[model samples]
Target chain A: MNFPSKLIEDAVTEISRLPGIGKKTALRLALHLLKQNGAVTEALALALTRMREEINYCKTCHNISDHEECSICQSHRRDRSLVCVVEDIRDVLAIENTNQYQGLYHVLGGVISPIQGIGPEELKIESLLSRITEGEIREVILALSATMEGDTTSFYLSKRLKDSKVKVSTIARGIPVGGELEFTDEVTLGRSILTRINYSQD
Target chain B: MNFPSKLIEDAVTEISRLPGIGKKTALRLALHLLKQNGAVTEALALALTRMREEINYCKTCHNISDHEECSICQSHRRDRSLVCVVEDIRDVLAIENTNQYQGLYHVLGGVISPIQGIGPEELKIESLLSRITEGEIREVILALSATMEGDTTSFYLSKRLKDSKVKVSTIARGIPVGGELEFTDEVTLGRSILTRINYSQD
Candidate 1:
């Protein structure tokens, strides 16, 4: 669409660069910003610029952080011996929100996807191995996705730590908690049966 | 959602302030920006800031412009005798894109909507009248939406210009060019039949 102003055109071009936003949506967003108070645009611009320029990754876990180490890594209450391995910081946020686990996280950044030209070396696997070598983390839980890339990454990490003394485990694979038996996929249903736990364990 | 960093939280909050975007989508966009090269965020911020700070409305027609006057109003080739009045700059762009009209445009900023607390005085009606009174524009075309508010604004403008020497007209209300008659609504189909033109006139 033709914009009446060059400034609007430029703004739309920049906004459409984002994922899921197209030129029309970008134009609508630009016009919306124009309709709102100037402070709205100012605050958005300032916040985004600050985030891009000043945000840091945790040196220990590779999670997004404002400082050298993330809050989770700095907290003394978390179980230092347990580390949950995941794909990125979003996964870290998801697991953290659940409040089921109280351990540090090791964000591998991404998985091994040959189609995308990504391999083990492209991720933060070295840092994760170094953390395990430090001898503080006793168990590493693989909390990655259930996709093929996730399986490949898990296999590679397990093979690399075969000689290490750290115990490597993976999150349980089964039907979702509220899922009905009839609607559940066969593979997950089979896994749920195979990994059935003692009813009185809780 | 819980953000790993305060910077990310701030960015997501600002992004979600815009129309349509929610907290989850905002978080996704913030993460996507972080994953991309820094230049993407930098350019977006700069463009939006510049647009918000420096963009102007055409002094005469009230259309969004980078300068005092818009290109449509500045062009000498456009018909000075005919003026198309619209609700906003987007309408001006839409009509211009058709490439069928050679007349200039007068953006009313918005239609008169009592529910939204918008009135004739709040729009550029006075400026449009002033332009018409200058004796150059012989015809005024109301190209506003076909909504109730649009009709109200058109009636208001036509009433105000009843005594003026310039002729007042509105866009034809009929079914769209490629629309199927069987699927067309009753009111639109009725209007189309009533306003049917001579085939040889084209």
Candidate 2:
């Protein structure tokens, strides 16, 4: 770990602070930057700095955006009455890539994980409730992950919205597409069988 | 990946340009940055920019440094008559980590590789000879990698240095420390057998 220069040591230290990147990988990356054009390093630095300083969060849905409100929340083509709730902005992109849902989305930022010291108060639950109370939403889909924290957040949200007029539902849990029944996990297989839908010709 | 913000997209693109990182990993890193304090990203950007703009190459050995000469070349404790020739700064670092050598180093930048369009003129071979011709150096050790290009470069250098008074040698090639003989490669095993040294009490 003997660095030839303090500048390189500083760069390596900062880069290795990122998750999954170790010191050796950071040194390799720093050397690569040194080998490339100065403009490349300058551009990367400018991009990261600008991204950190200028990005905004949608005031309503809590997703990242270039403006005060995200494009999805501002779009007129989306069904405002049907809202799909997800854990973070990445989930919003994943669901959008599927092209299956046309409704607007509400990002919860993160689920309630007591082990991580994250509770419902730290999430965007209050804003989501406010959006639902605004009276245009008729259905709310809990699209969180299948982990314990996801289920806890979903249950909490369902209880909070029990008095509201909006019907609360959750995305179906089952073996993934292209998954074999023999290799599927027990809980998933049992749930898929219990919630099996009647077959029909498309 | 349908990033919600243009800033995030730009950051992801630049971060993904680094070796071993992909769009998904870039996005994950970008999100992790967004989740943390803004100062973290700013520090990384600043460090990279400073390193790229201010880092220098040693005028003598071509190793990276903050000054005109590297610490190794400036050290009076090292044997000026003995020199270890390596391909890059990383190789110099690797040898330094061993703590066995007490000589100076000369970095040739890279080995001769036709596939990479690198010739003798592209490296610091001429400088190395000039240093040797100055009459202070008595021995030169070639510590390049055990690869085809490394051998080609070594051969070319030996031909050029045959008329010089300095003794030429190469780092020994054998099975790696703690390596299992059952899984060792054939070429290394054969070479180790041919070049076996007599056992001695150290």
Each candidate's DockQ score against the native complex? 0.74, 0.85
lDDT of all predictions:
0.92, 0.94
TM-score of each: 0.88, 0.93
What's the distance in Å from true for residue A108, model 2? 1.6
Off by over 4 Å in 2: A200-202, B200-202
* Docking verdict class for candidate 1: medium
- Predict model 2's lDDT versus the native: 0.94
Q: State the lDDT of candidate 1 residue by residue for B135-200, as single tens digits.
A: 999999999998999999999999999999999999999989898999999999998899988899
Worst 10 residues of 2 chain B by lDDT: B193-202
> How well does candidate 2 reproduce the true complex, by DockQ?
0.85
Q: What fraction of the native alpha-carbon contacts across the interface, defined at 8 angstroms, is recovered by model 1?
A: 0.91
lDDT of 2 by residue, B20-133 (tens): 999989999999998899999999999999999999999888899999999999999999999999998788888999999999999998899999999999999999999998
Per-residue lDDT of A64-142 in model 2, one digit per residue for the tens?
Answer: 9999999999999999999999999889999999999999999898999999999999999989999988999999999
